[model samples]
Target: MIKDHRPYVVKRAWLKFQKFYARHFLRPQLTRLGTGFTFMRPWHVELFGAPIRIGRYATVIATPDKKIRLSVWPAQAGKGHITLGDYCLICPGVRISSAEGITIADNCMIANGAYITDSDWHGIYDRLSFGQAEAVEIGKNVWIGDSAIVCKGVTIGENSIIGAGAIVVESVPANCVAAGNPARVVKRLDPEETFTTRAQFFADPAKLARDFMAWEQAVLQGNTYFGWLRHLLFPAKGD
Candidate 1:
């Protein structure tokens, strides 16, 4: 019986090429690029239609649009303008519409499928609302979980976390965990540890970079392709 060569060849091709980009080029680009951090892959940055400004040490992992619902308008005036602060982590499948402006402060962790918009885009009563909208500001150290929708004109205070699938319609105070469809405060966080800004982290670049690299190694060690490839190319001395 002949071995299945197709699958093996395909696997080798992917492992040799695509995996390297995913591990090195993609990950590093996402990790190192700031206020405007982006993945080199178009799918990773498709909905990022606007000119995004990412601060220092920010991570943005734009995921594939499996459902093909991403529409990044080319209108530079107000179509998409996303601002992310320092030490921020934006996961995959996060859809941010920028008919208006969207501001995310320092130390923010925006999880998968998190959507934030500054405008209704289509107007409240009519479909043809061709105009810029209000800006949404997410304060420092805010952690927005998966599938959270932050609507227009909403201000989320510092050190707050929006729980998964929450739809925020109003302003939330500092040091609180907000959740639900029309997101509300679920719990309050400690003042000391709650609100941390990007200005705080990048104050020491050397220390911050060192710490972040170490953390990245620990978090993505076995998960990254490089780690696996290294193991495959050079087995442990004792193993």
Candidate 2:
């Protein structure tokens, strides 16, 4: 069977176009956009207010309905800041709102529908008045699961994992896994085991990306245009 290289070529060109769009249109808007920052759907990333900085090699996967929102509210006492560190992966429906400050360190992976807020937004009784706002710090190499909420005055330590649907209200220790309504330390990670983070993927991104493309092309070698269309419309079994 004759191999078709058209799909591979088209995909490469589309990726180049997306990168161009992100650099020219989106990068200028942010307070600080570091080098090699990529977004799958850049249009879905909504940035409001100033002092929102994202570090190098960060990837954000956002959609229209599940937009990734990063906002910093101005304060009378001190300025609000939201800083995302290097090689972090932020999924769709991740809303990070800072009234005082919110800092997420390097190599962190935040799953979809996760909310990280530094303030209550409104007072308990006063309603109109703004509630207490404190700095929420998420340390390096943390993995926040789906639908988790990191509330005010919380510090999640390094190499920790927040389980799905967890609501973190207090400080989580390093190398531990936390879960539940008021996220508690359920298990501790083995300190002896060596783990790799997303940062390693971006270390040689160009070579890795080319390798991935080659693998994809090999997989779709005998696939026709019609076959591709059919796969999109009605996905194959076990796909």
Candidate 3:
């Protein structure tokens, strides 16, 4: 079988567009996009001066309606850091505030309305609130569900799932699925789930890409339109 460089080429081309836009259209216009992160419509909100390092193939989408509020700590005024590892998918409505530092590792999927904060943001006492808060570290291959809130000083381990509508108050270990208010570990994900199998590879990067291209071509050829027409004409298999 021949090695396909098309995917690599396509990805690099898109990365170029991302870099150009981040420097020219976004960074000067908005806040910071950092290095190697792709920001689509970052103008809607403000990400603090904290080094928002987005790894290769990581995406942060800030929509028109959703705005992310990032807090910059005075102690960290000169230096603050937020690092996201490779292939991390941050959906719309994700907000991260780092008064100290926050690290999210590779292949993590964060759904909509997920908020992560490393600091208390305000001092426990109003006077101390301005002081430096602790840092947060989220390990690799984590999935944070929609509308979940991860509070200050919490570290989520690798291969864990934070259920939708959960509020994380404490640290969670690897290979667990946590849910509910305050977010407790309900189930453990199998160790095998952490490693990608051959089927998964084909289903994700390979087949998914082919399917998308096919869908685009189908639309161009009116295949989808005619298929819908045929479906209306004959309610064949199942209603």
Candidate 4:
């Protein structure tokens, strides 16, 4: 309870199983799933209706309570598509529903509970009909904060940051931070400052994997099979 109780071998096996499950089951659902992509709790990642593509080294994390969902429902067939570029991070409870097009460029980090949609789903007067559609283009290294809602017809420029709980209805220019309801530009990011992206973080895939494995092994060093089982059945205080 306090830490991972599973033995090293068991945890390693579980990781392998998750990867296998993602490869055979989840990969088929996506139009294009790039190499070295890590989908933690892949079963909780839901992809509905196609032409949804994700680029290389993408990290998607989902939990049972907060599943990541990507859905495309066009007014007509082939009218909507979702594309995520390289080294993107999609956190739990992120829902991206497209009725037109959504293009997220490289090294974007979409935090937990962020919702990105390209259509209103219902018209203002008719109510039943799908409203107008406009494409949303999120440029490179953009960060969408937790619980932010990006409404229809918004384009977020490169290196822009959307603050937590912001409701974006209009376009955000490059190198700025936008927040609040109707999400106004709060501050301009200094373009001269150096920016480190997720792409750079995952530059060496093999080294990164090795580093994670080493850390896991070290942390789970004293764990045993029976200890793990006991913790699960009757967890102790500070377990």
Candidate 5:
């Protein structure tokens, strides 16, 4: 029995096209975007308010229904700012809004439905009055779980893990796991323990990308343009 490799080739071609579109169209809109930024569905990622900077090899995944929003609101004293460090991964339904500032350090992985805000948006008593704005800092190698909320004036230390559905209202110490309504330290990670992050994958992204393409070509060696067309029109049973 012959293996059908057309679907893989078609998928690879589509992804390459998306990457090209993202680089040419989306990169220009950003205040500062570093090299090798990959956007999985760039149309669903929204950015507003300037002075936002994202570092090299960052990957952002978004869908039409679960858009990833990064916004900064202007303040009377100082303007809002957002800085995302190298090799960060931001998943779908993640929103980062800043009135003062928000800084996410290198190799941070923000899970789906996470929210990071630096302002309350409005005062409790004074409906018209804007609430206090503060800086929110997320340290290097932090993992923010799904549906977590990191509120104003919060600082999550390096190597800390914010559990799923946690609401972080206070500072979290380094190398610890936090969870619950108001996130607190649940467990501590060993100081000497070493773990891999998204940074490792991006260290030599170009070479890895080339190798991937080469492998794909080898796998789809006998696949023709006609096969790709057929795959597009009438996808396989499992597809």
Candidate 6:
């Protein structure tokens, strides 16, 4: 109950199935998707409208309780583009709803329950009308913390960190840490220090895959198929 009851082979099979589901069902919905991407529980990820583009080596994790939704509802025929660059991490409950455009650069990580929007779907006075829509730009290696809301016309600079649960309405400068309801600049990141991005982490994809499988094998050393079934049937306290 403290550990994964499924055997290593079962884990591998589950991963393979997830990948298969992504390729077969999830890929067709995307406007563009590059190779070597992992979408865990791909079915839980909802994609609507286009042009929704996601680049290579992206790791998107979605759960039943926390579904990742990318919805692009263009006001006009030529608008609404949602672009996520290479080596990005999209966690559970991340909803990106774009009426114009939302551009997220490479190596960026969007934490769980984060919401990025480009349009106020409802007007202030006229609740039925869709209000102004502006493009949102997120620079390279930017980290959007859990439950953060990035509103319209916001441009977050490179290597900046948006604090957890912050509501961003204005542009965030590079190499800084922003927090609070309006999300002010609380601290600035060290320009001298090198940032280790997702691009760097996935530099050697083959090696990383090998190491990951090796880790799974080691961690699920004594797990069995029967044990997994037992746990599913009657889960214990730790489980």
Q: Please tell me which predicted candidate would have the highest TM-score against the true structure.
A: 4
Sliding window of 10 residues with minimal summed lDDT for model 1: 1-10
Q: After superposition, how far is residue 237 of candidate 2 from its true place, in Å?
A: 10
Tens-digit lDDT string for candidate 6 (1-239): 57788999888899999999999998999989999999999999999999999999999999999999999999788999999999999999999999999999999999999999999998899888788899999999999999999999999999999999999999999999999999999998998998999998889999999999899999999987888899999998987
> How does model 5 score by TM-score?
0.89
CA lDDT, candidate 3, residue 191: 78
Badly placed stretches (over 4 Å) of model 2 are 1-6, 222-239
Evaluated with lDDT, which candidate comes out highest?
6
Per-residue lDDT of candidate 1, residues 105-188 (tens digit): 878888887778777677556667644467789988788998889988899998888999999989999889988978889898
Residue 48 of candidate 6: its Cα lDDT? Answer: 91
In candidate 6, which residue pairs get closer than 3 Å at backbone N, Cα or C atoms, i.e. clash?
Answer: none
Summarize candidate 5's per-residue lDDT along 1-239 as a digit string, tens digits. Answer: 24554756576877888798778877776788988888999888888887788999898999999999999885655668999999999999999998899999999999999999999989899877668888999999999999999999999999999999999999999999999998999999998988888888877877989988888778878778787677768787764
Q: Rank the candidates by TM-score, best first.
A: 4, 6, 5, 2, 3, 1
Task: Note the clash tally of each candidate.
Answer: 6, 0, 2, 1, 0, 0
RMSD of 1: 8.4
- Local distance difference test scores for all models: 0.65, 0.88, 0.70, 0.94, 0.89, 0.95
Which wins on TM-score, candidate 1 or candidate 2? 2
Q: Write the per-residue lDDT of candidate 3 for residues 1-239, one digit (tens) a residue.
A: 12222333344456567567666755553333444455666565565564566666556677888765554443546545677777777788888877777888878888988998776666656865555477788988889999999987789998889999999989999999999998999998887754652224334555666785675444444324444455556546552
**Candidates, ranked, lDDT:** 6, 4, 5, 2, 3, 1
Error of 6 at 8 (Å): 1.4
Angstrom error of the Cα, residue 221, model 6: value is: 1.2
Clashing pairs in 2: none
lDDT of 4 by residue, 84-153 (tens): 9999999999999999999999999999999999999988998989988898999999999999999889
Residue 128 alpha-carbon offset, candidate 6, angstroms: 2.1
Cα-based lDDT at residue 235, candidate 1? 58
